[model samples]
Target chain A: MTTVIRELGDEQRELVLNMGPHHPSTHGVLRFVLHTDGEVMRKAVPEIGYLHRGLEKIAESTTYPGYVPYTDRVNYLEAMFANEAFSKAIESLSDIEVPERAQYLRAIAGELNRIASHNITIGCITMDLGAITPFVHLLRERETINDLIEALCGQRVTHHYVRIGGVAYDADDNWLKQVEKFLNHFEAIIEELDNLIVYNEILVKRMADVAVITADDAVGFGLVGPNLRASGVDWDLRRDMPYGIYPKLDFDVPIGAGEKGTVGDCFDRFVVRVRELKQSCRIIRQCINNIPDGDIIGNVSRKIKPPKGEVYSCVEGARGELGVYVVSDGTEKPYRVKWRSGSFSAMSIIEHISEGLMIADLVAVIATLDVIAPETDR
Target chain B: MTSEALIDYVKGLLGDKTKWADPEAGDNFLTVASEDWKNICQTLATDKKCSLTYLRNFTGTDYPEDDEIELTAHTFSYSEKHGLIIKTRISREAAVCDTLSKIWPAAIWYEREIFDLLGVSFNNHPDLRRILMPEDWVGHPLRKDYKQQETYRGIPTTRPA
Candidate 1:
């Protein structure tokens, strides 16, 4: 009466494994079809659009003011930057004027947002690179910035602090002082981070020359932000194409050291963001003192449409160059609204860049790209 | 360095071939044939003044009633300090265009999106797969001809097309 049970064969051979769209690590709703040859990745085809809500198409249907909330969720990582770009779009379209004070305040918050975003990227990079402790350490510091954002905008992550013409409100003196103090303390902490990871022999060996993307290929891939610059594209929307009070602000736009990939590698990307944190601190300090006094948001054109014309508004977002292309037909709602997202370019290159890499290295590559999946899908 | 000045100079480069470069207010745009978008993009990208390396976006708006698909390519020139929004329309029957991915690598995803939602095919895109839609999804959602009472996922949407 004994039954013989046979073990199923094909235990350790080549097989296709699906990771996400919801598996804790793909971040948010990202599906990666991983073809692995025993832990070594044969192919990593990231199937996105699982979360595409047709945001651009939706924008054309909604009124100008109504689309602000939608913009807040476009990237989700850099909501403040998204809000800024969206507001800039409306402002440019209708010629809604923003005053000097509002511009300075926008810069201040924009700089703070830059720091927050960089911290996330840094923490996430180390976290992916087998250093989980640094991720928590980075987030611990980032929480303070989040608290400040919450106090300023009444929400933590998706702080809809920006409006059409300018910011929704202004920061008090106490908040500005706190921001300044945070900036100074952040520099010392970042140095400690450098000591921890930047010069560490293990981290460098793991990261250096891992995923190399040439500058030419980077351009072909339409990469932007730190990812693009890391590959030797001397282009930054903030510095090269100035908007808000960024033109007046004095800070060095940090170029990638290029010690990693050809021009765009993971290590240089880390270097760029780390350097940007310091630059953002400098920009914020200057903004704190130079901030003027006036109305925050102006009267945006609410009821009617702009004209039977089109406008493209671009701004240097935390991730990359975020643009909103609007086609109006002299109505309440836009005839067409397309978001030229920076992440769009970066994400598109995954096919070209992610081919034939290891699983652990693939995750590292994903972090270096610094693309929020929602932004890519949306 | 202004858009108008840049357009004026570009017109000079074309030497009377530059037709339909309409300058409306601050925006100066040109409408070329869908087939010519890639070559034009290459010229814009490589030309000394119009170093429009950044393919700002590639999107299309559908008008089923008009039986046309208006495709737009927004390019920016860092050297000239101006942006040029190029627009062209193709017959609804043939919603096809040359892929600008070669001239501008950024256009790959954009072309995929245009292919995914708008149902516009890029002739030679390296990986012209669906971007914001699933691999086995039914129809392009952004197409004016396509009617969607609700999305494929049936995610309770109150907004109408």
Candidate 2:
């Protein structure tokens, strides 16, 4: 690694700088060896694996149903998506039919989790830019959603809500009422947040036209969710692939329109996430009103030993496409389990995009992409 | 194109170089030899009808019982909204295959990860190193026959059961 960095540095008299295996702005336990000639970076080589816990290896030893809680640890910010993806994989392997009401409940939980996740991404972008006030306001709104999720799943962060065939718990009338109320109130909160910091001059100046990723590059690098959409790609797994109750829900997939600057820039990524928060609220509102009364879990067997086969199931996670590839060998435990996370792919693109970018703008790019360390390392 | 038609199209393009797995099962893929892996991927990426621009998921699985390791690349087309899975296997003794990083930039890290955990090496990959594990880590941990090291740089890796 040193030889490679020296080879790149020898071209010009460059200063080598090490930024965090512990830097707050690097997101989590990520280190970048930067080759910079005083503030402009020639290359930023990201060094990862600080948070890798061998979740895939552990899955080979754990029972099919016992691995649900571990998926929560994959991406704690959007634990519902991880849980749903794993559950869908198992269901697909076994050909278990999830109850209609359970599908609606899973969608509701997932959207609420999406809103909570976007709150952190938008808040952290502003916070990383030195505007601390917006983070406080966003966290306040996130707390209400977290409290609502706690009520729904009986756990706060790592809610193991989705089971193999269906969901673990069902939503009652009172919980639905609270979710509706929160969506009604969150609509205005988003407007307030936009006014407070999203449209602030300093934030826009720091973010707009910085680290622009073109549409073709985005597709080639396999950017998903908001990052891909910000690059002007019209694709969303929920809409294009149509999983669960997303096909039944009526909502719009908001793409980057370059409202503030050039398309696929940092500002566009930030704005696309902000718009997604509203869209998530819209989807949750629809789910709340249209939830039906039925069984939450299906008639799944006690021993979940699916026939020998393999399946790849994914969900539109908070960050992007969170996928689980399961290869079962007619056993109670999974033969092999591989996670395809969005952050891992997003992190790989940093070396390509970080060329010629200022040190501070790199922070903006990482924050705007919302690359969570656990998801990337997992 | 649908999964069936996609398999047929790829079979027609690659002819004897590829063999299409039965589409009746889950995720039917085209099985190609190790030498033909890069050529088939290049054909898929550049072909006007296929044009699989996005490499959705790329991973490797260890099957020591069969004395072989399988690598799977799941490629998707944004314009057509269709996807195809490609599988290639190499002997466990010689786990080397041609890299697809030239075709899709997304394959760089994915190839490195497969090299890191499953002990598969990609030929001509720009940078192939341990990704999710330490550089000095001993053996591939994802392999079914792997044994955990007692300690790493004086830090114990195992705990009491």
Candidate 3:
């Protein structure tokens, strides 16, 4: 089976390598077709749809409330954002007002989910860069957040906590106290993890100055979330678009500062997520301190039939802007539902940036971009 | 700027090439003529005042009842901090519409996704291929009247229903 073949024409000599619908570093059932010239890649075209579950088509058949659980599968890593985006779209169309307490609860759950998602993102990137210890440490910290989330909502990964009009369940005072306790302990854990990987010379050398996305290119390509911010673009839907309780809460939006290398490089992307972790902690702290006491759910009917209209709602997911566009024809089920995900836009930019990059560096680009398969394929 | 002002600003720039639709039941959107789809988008991206540089979202919905597929391009201006929805309806049979990928690179994959799912082909698209569905799939899955193939490469798509 191992036979040597003679080389032919130059065009034919360029090897086409398949980088897995199963590759560990490729991250979640995604395949990349790499056109390589020896060790250097000419371009890496992403071949997706392995995880496509016809989710949008399914939305047409399911009722508004029934669709909440399905949105969880859209981006399992940041399921809270998917849930919130869909719920917000429905709520906006139906004119259902959530109680102040539910808004605070939703924000609290969202920020905590953001932290957990970023933990996995940073951990996976470091792990892909050959730093396993940091990934292990971050995973340990993530479990504590998961435990706190479990205390609030039963499930760990897909909380399904953010429902249309409001969150499914309310957090008890004890659970809120545990969240505060976790945040205090997790602040030191972030510092410890930073020491383990962020500033490490080896990881910096691997990521810094690689795949620098210009601010213009970032905006033009529709890159969202940290990936867009990593390119030094000061556009965050949470602040700029302002939804739910975000207008009342105070938190800083972190952008790429080029501490290790040029702005918008892989290093900047990594650093931005780390900075965002601190901001998420701050937002969660405020939500806990200023949370109002009231009804957890809104005055939504058991059977929600929104008026005939089309609305677009977005939330800042861990990856980027997770938006849900819904067209309701005065029915319980949506007429049309389209998801605009951060990873979907992030995936589109790869073929543009992967040119002339070392084959090994592609992993870093994929990691920093944080393009999850479920989000992209959904 | 507010959404109303932004719509008016865009209308003033485009002149007679587009029509502003004030749907009695739903939200308002700028509907561009089929021939002027690409021209209007190019202007929106390049015009100094209407710098909708970012193509936030592009989607195609099949409206079989109307015998047309509505393509909506949601554009946002990073500099101006405003956004407007541009929509155009093309005949479902023809399904050919101007591509926005040349103006906004983000639309490249989005157009492909629409083409693959809803069967709306974008003219002059760089690489128009099946994105979410298989290349040899029988029909556009998102179409309201789409029929599921009995089998894909000998693998049954549905349990004996």
Give DockQ for candidates 1 onward, in order: 0.53, 0.72, 0.71
**Model 2 regions lying over 4 Å from their true place:** A1-11, B23-25
TM-score of each model, paired residue for residue: 0.91, 0.97, 0.97
- lDDT per residue as tens, model 3, B53-117: 99999999999999999999999987888888898999999999989998999999999999999
Evaluated on chain B only, candidate 3 has a TM-score of 0.93
Assess the local accuracy of residue B124 in candidate 2 as a C-alpha lDDT between 0 and 100.
Answer: 95
Off by over 4 Å in 1: A1-15, A35-42, A260-262, A301-304, B20-26, B78-82, B149-161
For model 2, residues A351-375, the per-residue Cα lDDT tens digits are: 9999999999999989988889998
For every model in order, the fraction of real contacts preserved is 0.57, 0.72, 0.67
* Local lDDT at B132 for model 1: 80
After TM-score superposition, what is the CA distance of residue A24 in candidate 2 from its true location, in Å?
1.5
> What C-alpha RMSD does candidate 1 show over the true interface residues after superposing them?
2.1
Name the regions of candidate 3 deviating beyond 4 angstroms. Answer: A1-12, B24-26
Model 1: per-residue Cα lDDT over B10-94, one tens digit each: 7787654455644343355788776666777788789888887767777888888889899888887544567777777887778
Chain A TM-score of each model, in the order shown? 0.92, 0.97, 0.97
Model 3: fnat (fraction of native contacts): 0.67
Q: Alpha carbon lDDT of residue B121, candidate 2? A: 91
Residue-pair clashes, model 2: 0
